[model samples]
Target: MNNIILSIIFFLMLSTIVFLIKSKKNISKLFLSILIFVGVLIGAGLLYLILMIFDNDTNISDTIKTMIPLIASMVAAASVVIATYNTVNGEKSSKNKTILEFIDITRDILEKGEITEKTTEILEQINSKLKSTDFKVDVLVNNGAREFFEFLNAVEGKEKIYILDRLEKCFYYEPGSPLDDLKKELIRKLKSNNIKDMRKLWVNINQLAGTPAKNYNILYEECSYSLTNQFIEKDLVNSKFYTDSLLKNDRKIVDGLLRKHFELKYEDIPIQYYEVYRVCNNILESNYEQIGHFFRTVHRTLKTINSYYERNSLEYREHIGMLRAQIPNQVALLMFYNAVYSEKGRGMARELLASNFFGDRDDFHFENNELLRSEHFLNNGRFLNNQDAHIAYELFTYNKESNKVYNELEKMEKKVVPVDDSETKLKEEIFTHYLFNKEKILLDKFIKEFHTVPRKFDEYKIFMNPKNNKK
Candidate 1:
């Protein structure tokens, strides 16, 4: 029986040691664990003493044995109360409350560019938290960013973006710039920026990151993204986050976010076109294919946006969670997409027919001009009021018998076309306008939108067929 009890005590000690080794990292928590562990050991020792006292024939002292039990109980009870109080109080002031503590520390640092020793200590704590793999790792960073953003919104108004911009600029300046130089540089900016309210201009590099800013693109990007994301949360449109450009260095953050979104594999990609466009604007010149794949996220109506920009399996998943889209909205979006992608100075991609505006004289890609349907029409469904603009858009999108369009054009003087909410309406409207107006510019624009059609059709050969100009 003694041997069995000894084995049980041995196993308990082994388990306690393992738990201690695994969990006793924080100094404050370490004391609590040790205190509890010691209590266990003491209780075990006292019980063993009592058992031995009864088992052995030691002379006298039943009174001593009785007093021993009462004393040990009192000591054990007091030890628990003391340990509990210390651990709880330490926790309230330190590690577990790091989020709240970090936020206050960050705000103060941003307001004054002073980097104090407490800042360094907080850095140590922030780094330790970051080393943790659990979600709590981001608690300090996340809360700090949100609080700073709220502070900006409450006071700075639209100028908050300008202040946020300065904060990004100050924090992400030349990497590895010594703390002293960074301080001087910030002082110069503060004096020269001439903004009366500089409260929103502070950036706490220590609280945001536990290190210097030279190799800080990723950290800087995280801060900017966090704030912009908050900016978006506060107001989706008038404070439109995507309408503005981000620092060029932050492109990797965009790519990283895109990869995460791809991992989600949502059917309709929950992001707005403007948001994706901001990403594409950042990456299109550098990573055309990836940005192209990302651009495939327009609504189903402008299916060509997906197919034309980048045709991949991801583009065709045909889902977008609970969001729905209309043809007009998606078209306007791609118009912006096409113009941005086709702008000059994009390295070798500048020569691709896909990268030139439709109006460019040297522009030669007719098949890819499906995006022109959007260029001609406004997203709000109002601006394409000119009849010729509508005709030009129809010519590019609906690949129908050219002879039928020619016949409709020729006969429009006699009767109004019986067309409705269908492709037939567009054909009649376009043909009637072209037949009567017949302006050379309109004729040329119409043929250009359909440059792939056979060049020799008898009735439709009303002007120079654009297919002959194909490269």
Candidate 2:
């Protein structure tokens, strides 16, 4: 009889405590539950003992023994049921916390055009936790699918571009994610003639080399929408986008085609037509020393681009001429950045420059080492003070005058430039030539000679902004 009473008390106490801990219920409630169990157990025990003591029948002990077993079984079953219920509720609560946290992060991305490193760390933690369990991983993916569609319909302009880029990148770690579908859906929208700035779209699409998202057929179909034109020929090298896409294909055919083209050049196709193409060859095939030499001498390449710009009017309507005008500073800008910043593989960033158009590519590729360094370099964040290196070539290319380039560089070196007095004449004389070349050797030298240096991720929003692809 005593053992029966002790067993009932033990079950009640154990089950209540287990439920309280598992459910993470309030401590006060746990205490109250314990008190209730103990009071009931004591009362039941005392009553049973009293009944046994008063019994006078010869079969009383046997009857009491049977009653004790039946009561204990009922009590054990009830305690187990309570514990199971609490444990289930606890699991649901944990899942709810993950869902809410994911939603909050999605909202942050939508509102700020950025996310902090702390938030990224939190998301990583959540991702780790979710992967560690079978619960709620599908829930996040389902929610992501919903969010992806909603973003497709409602978002637009630069912000939409940014958000979509982040969406694909943020959930890249997720299995069976809808990002692949989301990209394909957006590409369909682009091809279906439902969106604006299709020209810009082609440029952005070409920048997607070295990515898992490379779907060349979708790109060709989209290109036919806006790019099948007088400026375009049925030939393989029709537009910069076509050339960039071709370079994206890695095969002996491209290499053989490159060899043949180099062997025989028809001058009708301007050097501008073949220069970037040739650079692409060097980019994909060059040895380390050869690449170093090319960067070291790239100022000469910039000069050739400047020469092309001088012969054509910036107002030229032919897409070829317009592309010609855009390529010079585009080359300088990308090459300078690829050389200076040590983020993405130099090869990756270099290849991206092949598809470069009017500098908006920076906004889309916010994470590239090149873009990251440019961000801080322009803002004078840590490495450089003269942002003129960022835009000096733009003015130089536009005006076809070395003086315009000289002026920006001169402005940057104010301690040396514009001093007409006799004391600084020699200093001005030396700095004069450095500031005013058709192709400034100084910038090229900076790129070629610059060794990969360490940078802090926290210094710019680029690193903390998540590994997003807004660039």
Best of the candidates, lDDT: 2
- What does candidate 1 score on TM? 0.17
Candidate 1 lDDT over 322-361, as tens digits, reads 1111122332333333332233212111111121112222
Sum up the clashes in candidate 2: 5
List where candidate 1 sits over 4 angstroms from the true fold: 1-150, 153-180, 187-275, 286-337, 340-471
Clash counts per candidate, in order, are: 6, 5
lDDT of 2 by residue, 327-362 (tens): 333233434443333222232222222222323323
> lDDT of candidate 1?
0.35
The candidate that achieves the highest TM-score relative to the unseen native structure: 2
Per-model lDDT: 0.35, 0.37
Q: Which stretches of candidate 2 lie over 4 Å from their true place?
A: 1-57, 114-471
- Between which residue pairs do clashes occur in model 2? 364-470, 364-471, 365-470, 365-471, 366-471
